[model samples]
Target: MARIVVIGSGMGAMASAARLAVAGHRVAVYERAATYGGALGRFERDGFVFDTGPGLLHLPAVYRDLFVKTGKEPLERCVALTPVDPASRHLFDDGTDVSLPNASRAQVVSALDAALGVGAGERWGDFLNRARDAWDRTRRPLLEEPLRPDWQVLGRDPYPSVRRRRVLRRDQWAATVGEIGAWELADPRLAALLESYALAYGLDPRSAPAAAAVLPYMEQTFGSWYVRGGMRELARALYERCLARKVEFAFGAEVVAVTEKDGRAAGVELSDGTVVEADSVVFGADPRALAGMTSGRQAWAPGDVEPGPVPPGRFTVFLALRGGRPDGTVHRTVVHSPDAGAEASAAFRGEHSGRPTITVLRPDDPVTRPDDAHEAVTLTATVAAHGPVDWTDEALVARYADGMAAAALPAVPDLRERLLWREVRTPADTAAATGAAGGAVPPPALAGAEGRHLHTANTTRLPGLLLAGGWAHPGGGLAHAGMSGALVAGLVVEGDGFRGSQ
Candidate 1:
């Protein structure tokens, strides 16, 4: 059995450690922080709790597969996963409101038709069917496997974009998310709904490839899930699974540099001046830190996918309200901005948009509140990743959070009066917690725009070193991060010929 050293204790790292251990390798995970989970953080006060990371889980089969591969107990036995009904409530600026049922195409169609117009449902249904075609085309290459050497082939757009006739008698093709929305959806509300997914995932709809439609298709088709306590529970379950698989963890052990012997990875040098030897190194931290550790050693040769620019982080406000959660309240509510395109433009430009696209989450879980008489609510918005705006500036963060809460008024009509206390977090906190450059959250890989949307492969030019995390192959989002681990393990255990899971 080879001795493997895994960096960071985030879900992706832990998932790799568990799988490698089960494969009979001796694995040790060294984390810079005192705890694991990375972005899957939590906030609490007076028995009120809020998930600081992703509020819901889409494509949960990633974790389910992880649990099954690593341990005797299944994922269901480790954590309570419940389907979130009325998957999401969209509150458009035009006073158009609709709640889509979880993974029920007919129900989603009916709801949209009733709220937007008679033809709206059919339009959206047709769009989703097209989105499904994209998903089927890219799912295996993008999610179920490691980034291939001939990844440029993925540069081809797989969305089967609709073609239209232009005034000049030329064929107009939809390439970006915005073009797809404008040309196909043909409804401002439908366009906003589609663009919201792009913004939430740190992509501007104007530039994000039409393949991005796969995002909504994945969510509406697979359905959204919630853990009993919070998303933190999913992390805890994965960590515990790692321990059960005999993967050792060294918390607060920051790796300073990667040691090399005869131009191959020999071990890792810790911040405390300790050198730990290993046969292979699995880095689950940010690519920035990896570069620092590699010294002059290049991780990628020419033509390899370059790590894209750091993405914008999220701005969150956790509210402890006195009023109980009202009945018939949907778990997730998205309040669209008056001009979503403008908001997205401002965000990408690192400027503040007067109107913000707000996502309000109020899970119907008891542990989040002190009692049934109280409620815990979370409001979040996409903002410039910490750099352009000083997220460390307290006054600035509070001011932005104030706007987010105000924007959320549509979701919580009595937000001001019901609020008892509030907590705000910026990308600065994310930077402190996970050491990501600019506190940026990585975006998932998309199959278009000349492969500008793909992430660096797991296998680096530096032998014996691989990547598995948000910044790695398959890219970000809770589910994709887990897939990175699976890919890393498959590469290590099965050698270079490993394609992916069957």
Candidate 2:
């Protein structure tokens, strides 16, 4: 058995550690913070609780597989996973409202038709079918396996080529997401709905390739889920699973650098001046921090492609409400911007918006509040990653938080009056929590534009060194991050010939 050292206790790292341990390798995880889970953080004050990270889980099968591979108990035995019916309520600027049922294509179609127009549902359903084609074509290469050496083939857009009649000649099928929104969806509301899927994951729909359609297809097909308490419960379950497998964890242990011996990763040097030797190292950190640790040996993984601008980070407002959550309220609501394209432009340009597209989450779980008489709500928006804005400026952050709350007013009537207190979390908080560069959140790995959406490979130039996190292959999001861990373990355990878990 090889001696493996994993950096950080992020879900991806923990997942890999547990798997490697189950494979009979001695594994140790070192986290800079006092706890694990990375972005899957929680906050509480006076019995009001909030999930600071992702509020819902899509593609939960990723974690289900992790639990099955690592322990005797299944994921369901560890945490209560509830399907979020009417998954989300969309509040369009045009006053068109719709609540979509979870993973029911027919229901979603009917709801869209009822809310938008008779033809709208048909158009969206057709789009989803096309999106499914893309998903089926790319799922195995992008999610189930490590980044391949000949990854350029993935760069080819897989959104099935289409032929259309034009006034003068045949029109070429759309390439970028913006093109797809304008050409295929046609209806502005439909375009906005499609774009929202990309925006939520820090992807700029305007520039994101057409393959991004796979995102919505995955969500609407697989279904959205919620844990009993909060998403933090998922993290806790993962941590416990790792412990059950005899994977050691050193919380608050900061790694200073990745030590090398004869051009191979030898071990890691801690901030406390302790050196832990290892046969292999898996780094689950921001690209910037990982590069710093490598000390000029190699900065990027093979087949790594730059996706142009750095991805944005999340800005959140956690509200401690004064009143109870009303019955019959949807679990999540998306209050779309008046001009979503303009909002996307302003966000990518690092300009703040007084009216931004906001997502409001009001889970009915009792553990989040003191009692049924009270409620906890969370409002979030995608904002510029750390460097562009000074999120540390308290006044600036407060104003942004207020703007988010204001934008959410349509979804939550009398929102201001219902709030007893509020807290704001910025990209700076994310950076501090995950060691990500400028709190930048990486979007999940995608195909199109010749693989621009794909992140660096898990296997690096330095032997015995691999990556396991959003910054690595298969990219970000709760599910993809878990896949990153699986890939890293497969590579470490099976060596160079390891393609991926069957």
Report backbone clashes per prediction: 0, 2
lDDT score of model 1? 0.91
- Against the hidden reference, what TM-scores do the models get? 0.99, 0.98
Candidate 2 error regions (>4 Å): 164-170, 301-308
lDDT tens digits, residue span 1-502, model 2 = 8899999998899999999999999999999899999999999999999998999999999999999999889999999999999899999988889999999999999999999889899989999999999999999999998877889999899997456667889668788787788888889988998899899988888888899999999999999999999999999999999888899999999998998999889999999999999999999976556666888545565445543457899999999988889989899999998888887886788866667789999998999999988899999998888878888998989888978888888889988888889998899998888778778888998899877788888888889988888888899999999999999999998999998878
Model 1, span 1-502: residue lDDT tens: 9999998988788888899999999999999989889889888899999998999999999998999988889999999999999999999988989999999999999999999989999999999999999999999999998888999999999998888999899997799999989999999999999999999998889999999999999999999999999999999999888888888999999999998888778889999899999999999977656777898555877889988877888888999999899999999999999988788887888876777899999999999999999999999888888888788888877788888888899899998999899998888898888888777888889999999999989988888999998888999899999999999999999989999999
After superposing candidate 1 on the true structure, give the runs of residues whose Cα lies further than 4 Å from its correct spot: none
Residue pairs that clash (backbone atoms under 3 angstroms), model 1? none
Q: Output the number of the TM-score-best candidate.
A: 1
